[model samples]
Target chain A: MATFSFAVMAVLPLFLMIFIGYFLRVFHVFKESFFNEVTRFCFKVAMPCLIFKNIYSSNLDVGSYVPLVVFGITGIISLAVIGCLFIPLTVKDQKKKGVMVQNLFRANFFFFGIPMITNIFGEEHIGPAVMMVAFVVPIFNILGAVVLAFFQEHEGKKRVDFKDILHNIFTNPIIIGAIIAFLFVLLKIPLFDFVVDVIGDIADVTTTIALISLGGTFKFQSAKHNMPYIIRGVLDKLFLVPAIMLTIAVILGFRGPELAICLALFGAPGAVASFVMAKEAGADGELAGQLIVFTTAFAFVSLVFFIFILRSLGFI
Target chain B: MASSFSFAFGAVLPIFMLVGLGYILRRLGYFPEAFVTLINKFCFEVALPALVFYNIYTSNTTIGQNSGLLIFGALAICGIAAVSLLILPKLVKESPRRAVLAQNMFRSNFILFGIPMAANMYGNDGVGPASILLAISAILYNILGTAIMAYYQEKQRSGKKSVHIVPLLKSIFKNHIIIGAALALVLLSLQIQLPNFLDRTVSDVAKVATPMGLMAVGAHFNFARAKADFRYLMIGLSGKLLIAPAIVMIIAIFCGFRGPLLGALLGMTASPGSITSYVVATSMDADGDLAGELVVFGTALSAFTMFGFIFLLRSLGFL
Candidate 1:
């Protein structure tokens, strides 16, 4: 019962906070353009800091998890296969195929996954979770992009430039964060902690403002047109994918913090990456928006149900 | 519960404050163009790199039994993502926009969102491995991901493709962030530490980067444009935020990733489309608007898709 209440308390406030920002925007308590700016902040500043701090501070064994690494790479390969199988059955647009390939593996581990995992498992479980997120996400990005480009080439279209991939992966802020941190760890070089501490000190404002700003962008009316896509998206993301992940985790004997964090991560709502991908592919941005709204709305219930089941089974 | 509240509050409050304030200032017309440029440059060139460098300089390494696992684990994830791009297209009829959509669905936001969140969750321990994986991903993205994009464009034009090694090497060297990262690594390897004054200055500058960047983000909404390009965006969003992560998870399980590694792998699986994707799209002239929409849509949808993924992982005791 205590755990149940704890679960509610953990999730409710987060939802409430975002909703409050949303209502404040709706009521005109704040100016309308706030969300756009906040979203910008999240992209430009806060998130980068978050990545830097995480990568730098952790003490990790980059070589300990061969099995896990192999597993992750194989997982991406499977995503392509799954996407290929479905492509023929349902959709046909080449760009949409590219989009499908990307979304099949893009997970949100930062805000949603971290909080939920920390909430349920405490701080101890954070390290491995972070490692998995850092390593797997980027590989997913690069490989996913490559696969998309390959399909484009097969159609006799202009392919994604190999140079672009290299430039993007290596020079990217997050990837840089991962690399630099790893080197620092490997070399045993110690810097004055104040450097990051100062940044860390100011970090909280970035995400909060972004969330509030996102709230300001909320337009209930906008959701009307993209309902079908949103529904389908929710079905695929909030239901089917997670169900599949759970079956796999159970069969594989994952337990404790690993299980908890994985579940929390699986339950995370669609990331803003969907919108980015849609815009890049010249797909329906509105559909992406609808997915965000719809999935976020449903995630509350799904997460709660997840917690209940986990606690009942003594998993948490 | 209290701890969780405090943790969340700690994470979000500052963002709320800065963005909220920035919005007010923007509406007041207090932010000049020069100011915006300065802010962007500071965030991008100096502060951002410092943040990355500082973090890297502080981490601890794990190299024994864990080494093989990290390498193989990353390889597996990369392999899967590549395979997805291939397979997804086969399931659907090929079309002109397939390249863009496939890229959207397959790619992820590693640095912007994933790193920080990983930091907050795992601290230094997870950050170390995450960084290594990130490097591997970087190599893969540049070599494999970009190759695919280029191939598509070539095929669409003349159906003729050839490897252009010189251009690729030039581009690789020219990437600012990568260069910065490489420099930092070299410095770390050389055991060079910044002087206190320099360190303090860089750190101070870095400190301002996040809040300022966040403010800039707040001012960057394009609902009007997004609304104009709804359909194509939705397709991209669906592929990226939904299908992409689903496929990754299945593969991860089949490949036997479990425990914290599995959780982290899954965590990475659901990231939204990266801004880097936008950069690549623009450079290649493939569909920038579509890329932007994917970033937007992928980000928004992640809230729910992530939750569902978490729920499933929890039920299966893999959290």
Candidate 2:
């Protein structure tokens, strides 16, 4: 019961924020363009600052968490490989296969995962979770870009811009933030208190703004039309992936907060980036959008269940 | 004295640096024109509101405590508006230009510049009064600006004159700054403490508003257009940053307003012409170019004028 309440407490504010975004959109308080721009700002500016601050402040020892790091990387890569192989076989449409595959593997680690971990473990003990982000986010981006590029609509007419892909992956704001933060931590550089305060301020609103924008941009009409694909995508993301990943981690002797972090990494909603990548890459943007909405809507139940089970088993 | 000068300089320099960086980044194509607009929108909608809300909500001071400062701020704004309305018409002949000039002279960029400056001077204690003053001043400027524009516009169109109260009220209510302040005040009154996560999230996002706002101000600075309307521009700047503030400060000091209250007033009175005045002018078919020039010049000159105010205030031991 305690774990259940904790999960509810953790997820409630996030949903409320999304609802506010939706209300604002419906009431014409915020225009669609405003939501888009704010989301981009959150992703590019605020999220990076947050990741950097979290990792930089953490007393992370890379050498100590080698097993967990190895497990996380292996889990994501295998999930991507499995998604790539299975999605194409099931989905007849070429454009949709890539998006589905991408959705299957890429969790909302940046938005949902980090905040969830912080909630469950508290801020001081989230070093391993931040480390997971540092490893998972870049890999997710690279794989997402590659998958989108592979199944781009005009594949025969236009060659894929490898430079753009590499640039996007390398210059990704979250990745850059993680790298800079790692350097700061590794080199033992002391940041000014005011600077840290300012960064902390910027980082604080990232999740709230992102969640609101997610709600604002949500298309219920699209979900209605793409119900089957959305359900499949949600099941794959919210259930199958976490189930496999957490079991693997538990079997590998991972326990407590480590397992909790794994659950967050794997069990959260499909990333909003999937929709962005789909639209940009000319894949099935509608399906991707629906996937995000459904997964997000159902994520609370899944998160609560995971926490309850983990707590009951004394694994977290 | 030297230490005070350094302290004042340290408080003000980061703001200028961010603005300068914004100008350079925009010039170098690092931030596209669309991106600049987007950043401004985000600041106004999300960041600035959050900052105001958080500042006011977290403040231990009550509205009753700062009622004097609030009343003084309202009176000062009204005084400036009245003076500008009476004097600006004689200086600028065209009715639209007169209205825009009058509005620009009285309406300072209080939110972007004032709160931060006050906070710098008095730390956390300053923010409470500054934010309250911001809420009051924002409403005053909007209503006064609309009335002036409407009066002139009516004269130009059909010679029937009355402020469009409905639309004006709609705008005032819809304003994110006003909404933020109002919501924060409500929360404060209710004794509601936001959850730890929510509070941290808001502050983080709210922190972006100052730097982003100053940078947007810098990025939007127009050199070419500013030179075109030098005569009217000078009038607007002097009225906004120098004459208006000086009069207000003397009165405030005489009224026993000292410390953060005085600092807050100085910060508000000494700010530049609001960027909103330019938007209002352009949309209302007034001398938007002149309004734009006033904003650019008024803002450019304000950095020095504001520093001088801070210096003088500190020297007098008021801050």
Candidate 3:
């Protein structure tokens, strides 16, 4: 009972934040322009600073990261492979098929992962979780680019070349944030105290802003026309991936923070960035957006159940 | 005083760094021009109020314990405005610019920075005094700001457009931050509590206040504008960030203020010029260029001044 309540406590407040944002938008307190501008600020600047600062400050301790790095990479790839294999069976629209595939694989670890780790174990124990971004973000972006690039050509659009895929993955802000932090850690580069504090300030604000902005962009009307597709995407993202990856994790003897991080990396909502990537890559942006909302809207229940089950089994 | 030097350094450094980060990101073309304006609206209309309400509601310290903050803050604001009005007419020469200077001297960006700085110095629960100060000072800022600008605008324009009591009251009551603070106070007085989920929601929203508030301030900072309007900029920066706070610090210390009380008071009197100064100035037919320049440059130079004052106060054990 205690563990179950802890699970509820862990995920409830974060989702309530989104609910606050939705009601604020409904009352017209947040206008249309707010959604895009704040979202842009969060992803482009604050999110990067968050990942960068965490990895930079963390002890490199490479002996410990073997599980997270190895499992994290394979976990994402397997989910992507699973997504590629199964999405066409579930979705009909070619553009939205890519979005669903993207949804099934990509967890918004960039947005939700850090906060969830912080929520469960407190901020001090979040280093291992933050380092997960260093490995996870690149795979998510590369796969996102490739999936969307291939599906986009069905609309008679020119396929994005392999070089462009490499370029996009390398140029992604969150990936760059991770890369730079890796350099700082590996190279033992010492930042001035003031510089660290400044970035820390930016890092501190990232998750809350990302969550609220995600809420501001929440539109019920967008989901009205595509409830069936949305439900399938949410189910695949919130349940199927976790049921698969987390099982593999337990089989491999993963437990504690690593296992908790895996749960966060797999079980949370679909990536918010998937919507933007879809819109830009000529996929069904509306479906992408809907998947994000419903998955995020439903993520609380899914997370509580997963966490409670894992805790009862003593897996994490 | 665990190294007062480091204490002050920790508090002031992040603020400048945030502003500098915004300035650099903007220079590199990451922040579009529109992001600054829109985010400012987000902070004021949404984040600032939520921060104040959350801080006051969650605080165990009741209003009676910090009642002196209300009295001290009000007196200091009114005192400085009186002084500025008495001395600035002969000093500034032009009626519009004088009014702008007068307004800048009395008003700091207290609503945005008050809780954040207090929280920064003394953690989240320590912001009770600051939130109480916010509710009172927010109303005072608007009333005084409008009265000062309107009085001089009338004087300069041969009595064309001066203040009206109804409009003034309406403007104060209409402001989102003031309304938020007022709501919190009403609930506080009645000993009402928000339902658990709603209470948590406000706490979550309030967490965004400092970082976003600082980022928005940083993004709006205009470095190039500093070079053109050197004179008014000097006066506004020196007066608001240094001299006014300096005078108020003596009074506070003499009255035995210390710790987070002093930090909240510093936020009230020593922060940068309010961005709204430009809006209020131009609306009253004042010199928009000088007002804009003062605000732009005041914010830029405030980093160094904030560091100095915080460092000094820390060394003195008044923070």
Candidate 4:
């Protein structure tokens, strides 16, 4: 019962902000262009600062990296491979296979999941979560590149350009941000106090702006057709994948903050970047958009429910 | 919280340092005006609102707590407007220019400057007083601005006086600044509690409001405008940036305002002339050239004046 209130207290406010964003849009308090620019700003400026700052401030144990890293690094790849192979059977359309594979495999761990951790469990526990984000981000990117590269192949770019994949992976804002922060941590780079303050301040702005941007970008003028694919996408991304991962983490004896972190990272909605990638790749962009919308819209209730259950069961 | 931490020099330094960074970056051609404009808009529409809302929602401050700041802020604004109205015509003979000068002298960029100053001084909770002052300033600025402009235009036309209350109220109703502050006030007054994550998110964004806003204000500085209509620019700026603030701060001092309350008043009175003066001037067919010059000159000169004023106030232990 105590944990029940804790669950609500931890989760509800972040989700309420999305509705506030929606209402702002509905009342015409904010325009669509603001949403587009804010989304870009979050992606380019705010999220990078946050990712960099989190990793920089974290205290990592070199010995402790054995279990969490091995699981994180290998886990994402296996999931991506399974998604690429399995999703194609159900999701026809060469275009959709790529985005579907992305939708299933790419969790919004950094944007939504990481903030949720700091909000619930505080920043001290973020060392492991940050490691997960650092390793998981690159894996997600490379997998996304490979999957999209395969699908875009059908559009008559016959050569599988290895150069393009490398460029795509290295140049991703999130990956670059993570890499830079990692380098700073490893080298013990000393920064001016005020500069650190500025970085820390901007880093903190990420979650609110991202959530509000999500609400603003949400399209109530959604498509009527292909409701099934959207439903399937939401379930696979929010429910099945998270359930399997949480159970696996539990069986592995992960508890407390680590268990909560797993639930959040695995349970988060599909990555917003997947939609951007899909649009750029010319693959079922509308479907990708809807998948982002529904999964995010539902993740609030689902994530809260999961937290409540886990807390009650004393599993986390 | 304010008792535990003295933000006197610590808070004031960050504002100017970021502003200096912005000015240097702008001068080096690294941050262009268009980029600063976008940043300004982002800060104004999205981030600043969240900043204000976060401060108001998270703090245990009530409307009654800030009634003094609200009353004094409104009174000081009206007093300035009255001075401008009574004195501007004698100083500037042209009808359109009369309205422009009055608006320039009366309006201050409290939103950009006030919130940041208060936030820096007293931290997040201090924003409650600052925001209430902001709402009062916005309301009075619009009312006085429209009436002053309409009064001049009416004189030029030799026609009946008219002030569009409905449209003015509607605009104020939808204003993003008021919306943010108002929503928080309503929620607070209703004894409502938002989710913790929401407040946490708001706090994160609020931390950004000052640095980005101050830097944008710095980048917005145009030294080239120093040569444009040099004499009148000085007149408008001196009155807006110096004389008006002096009058208000003196009155506030006599009223026993000190500490964070004094800090909030300093934000209200001592900041530069508002950027909106130009917009309102042009739209009202007033002397936009003079309005534009006053804003640029006032803001540019204000960086120096504000630093001095803040330094002086800190040394005097008023804030």
Reference contacts preserved by each model:
0.06, 0.09, 0.70, 0.30
- B94-164 in candidate 2: lDDT tens per residue? 88889888898778777667887787777888887888887667657766776677667766765445556
Return the TM-score for chain B, candidate 4: 0.64
Per-residue accuracy of model 4 over A1-316 as CA lDDT, tens digit each: 7777777766666676677678768878677766776677677666777777777877576467667567655666777789878988887778788888888778778666666776677877776776677677767777777787777745455455678777876887777888998898889998766666666766666677777777877886656786888888888888888888778888888788778767766788877778887887777888888888888888887788888888888886
B1-319 in candidate 4: lDDT tens per residue? Answer: 3421333334334445565666776786656666665555556566666765765565554568678788888888888888888887677778888888888877877865667768876787667677777766765676677667655655566543554565545555554555777788789789888755566656665655565655555666555654756766767888877888877777888999888888787788877766456545654567765675676556656766776667777788887
lDDT of 1 at A310: 67
Candidate 1 residues B125-161, lDDT tens each? Answer: 5465566555545445544445556656555555445
Clashes of each: 219, 3, 0, 0
List the pairs of residues colliding in candidate 3. Answer: none
lDDT of 1 by residue, A1-316 (tens): 8666756654554465467568867776555654564465565455555655665675655575554556555655675667667744664555555555455555555656655665566555565666666676667566656655555525455566778767866766556666666677778778655455545644544444454455566666656654555566676767666667755765676666666555655566766766665665455555655566667777777777677766777766
Put down candidate 3 lDDT per residue, B1-319, tens digits, no spaces: 3343354345456666766676777788777767766665666667666776775565554568788888998999999999989888767777888888898998877654556667767886547778777766765776687777666755664554455566556655665655776788789779998866567667666767666655555665665655655777777778887899999999999998888888888888877766566555654577655665665566656656766787788877778
Candidate 4, residue A11: lDDT: 67
Report how far off residue A307 is in candidate 3 (Å). 2.9
Flag the better candidate by TM-score, 3 or 4: 3
lDDT of each candidate versus the true structure? 0.58, 0.75, 0.75, 0.72
Give residue A254's lDDT in candidate 2 (0 to 100). 91
Give model 4's TM-score versus the native structure.
0.76
Error of 1 at B15 (Å): 17
Model 2 B-chain TM: 0.71
